[model samples]
Target: MESGDLLLYKRAMFRLAHISDVHLGPLPAVTYRELASKRVVGYVNWQRHRRHFLHDGVIDAIVGDLKGACPDHLAVTGDLVNLALDGEIELARQWLETLGDPRDVSVVPGNHDAYVPGAFDKICRAWGPWMAGDGQADPVGRYTFPYMRVRGRVALIGISTARATAPFMANGFFGNGQARRLAALLDDAAGKGLCRVVMIHHPPVKGAVAQHKRLVGIGRFQQVVARHGAELVLHGHSHLPSLYWIGTAQKPVPVVGVAAAGQGMGGRNPPAQYNLFGIEGEAGQWRVHLERFGLVGAAVLPARIAELELAPHSAQVSLSPH
Candidate 1:
């Protein structure tokens, strides 16, 4: 490449690392009082199957590999804890610290984070810094969804699909309120010529998860995306690596998912993994290259399992209603 082209490439490139559904564990002993509520089900589930799959060592290795890649920012799409136990929340906080400064890491809570009615509040308080919007103060008790954080040329918009659900349910909600706010944020980000990356815990794509674990307002969520358009969407809940397209054929948006970060080898789900997105180019013509790294088969260290260039944004157009 010529000198001018090389310079332009360097100027436009932004590397982002994505990981989710950590379900961080070795459950801190729970008391009979704590297990009195919905925690009982989750605790039981953890003991039976999740404990065998989700491993802290796997998370450590993934994080270590991700840091070595040195992406410009890290997007952790949630399920940071298995039971949303107080101790689990604190442990997640410490792990976040190991990842990077709050400014460098962005997080969104998952169904497990808000495992119970009051668990969401605890998550907001403890993981507030990583979840806070640009120029926003540390959330005291509550933080609104559809938060925006700009890093160089990208706008990381986080929306929470996390909510307390009845026992035996792992659903999420994306109400109309957040939809309106998200549309506005997308509009503003587009106006600024920033690449919009929407982050959510539950996959907005239809049939992405079982009926009980689906996103409640999936239609409204897609309506907003189809109307305003987004460069990319990242989500977690399925605990498997997946890719789906939303929006019109002319301006399709890539909805990407990753395997649970703490999932060990030989589990039902794929081994722990993360995605590295290399985004470059300007508003009308953008290019995104995805590099997936993880433990495959019986390998101990994470390796680059897949790499591909995503659909490029050849035109700056939106399907916004006239």
Candidate 2:
């Protein structure tokens, strides 16, 4: 083994902080010009001057707990913004900057990041400073996903589920290039005896938005994953956590989803929650201890788990399909 490998192994208790769907900054009241339509925006307009669900307090608590947990690495699944607004991107940037390092943090863009026309190709570049430089591009921005960073043999594979879809579609998609590249990435990483963790903006399993089932063409992606196998898979578009086993001929990868750290409607679920995974063992022989950290009244409560085991975003734009 390498030098620092022992430290990670000896500790065998490093924290993996997972958070998604920030949806920062509310929408400003606009003039309809007709003078008839009033009362802010839509009937369920979540982005108003006032806080609807996700608020600053929620983020503050989450950030504090994240620091206290002392995670070795951080992964953000996506939906960093609410309406794909320009300001929202910067807002998300500030929130994420609180983390220790950019190299240790990995992210994938959700549907909202690309909701407006050419949002990904346009706005995401500006998010560079926050992430320490254009956030690791993939050849002419063809696929903006970042490669896995190895921390004591732990590999993080990030995928882009950000696509510009049709109106009334709150769905996500992954193209051909991304799928093929992802398959190869998994194979290579697995061969290296590295713990492979796949991160995306949408859930590869199902649920979240029903009816139209905008999960169009995830079958191939699933097939590739099953072919090579993964240790863990993570996402955050649904604003809820659903666990599943996506196994290949080689091994099984536990896929999980989490809610928005800033979203909590009348204390709907866990007010602005985030997940922490404590893993132990080697590449293919790893184990997970999943627990949650969230806001409790005014004090950030910690739902800590000691050497445990087990497993376990947003809206906008009518893209892909609803």
Candidate 2 lDDT tens digits, 1-322:
8779966564776568899887665653434441122222321456442256777666666767787877888888877775655556666676667666677677777887777566776445755432221334433243545455666667788777777665556577777877888888788888888788888877787445564435555686688787777878888877765566666534656777676777654645445678888777786578776776555554455443222245321111111100
The digit string of per-residue lDDT tens for model 1 on 1-322 reads: 9999987775668999999999888999899999999999988888898999898999989999999988899999989998898999999999899899999999999999999889999989899999989987646343378899999999999999888899999999999889999999999999999999999999998888999999999989989999998999999999878888887777888888898999997777788999999998888677888888998777788999887778745322211101
Off-target runs (Cα >4 Å) in candidate 1 are 1-12, 138-143, 312-322
Off by over 4 Å in 2: 1-10, 28-44, 47-50, 128-140, 248-250, 265-269, 296-308, 311-322
Q: Could you tally the backbone clashes for each prediction? A: 0, 10
Candidate 1 local lDDT, residue 134: 91
Candidate-wise lDDT, in order: 0.88, 0.65
* Candidate 2 global CA lDDT score: 0.65
TM-score of each: 0.93, 0.80
Looking at candidate 2, the ten consecutive residues that score lowest on lDDT are 313-322
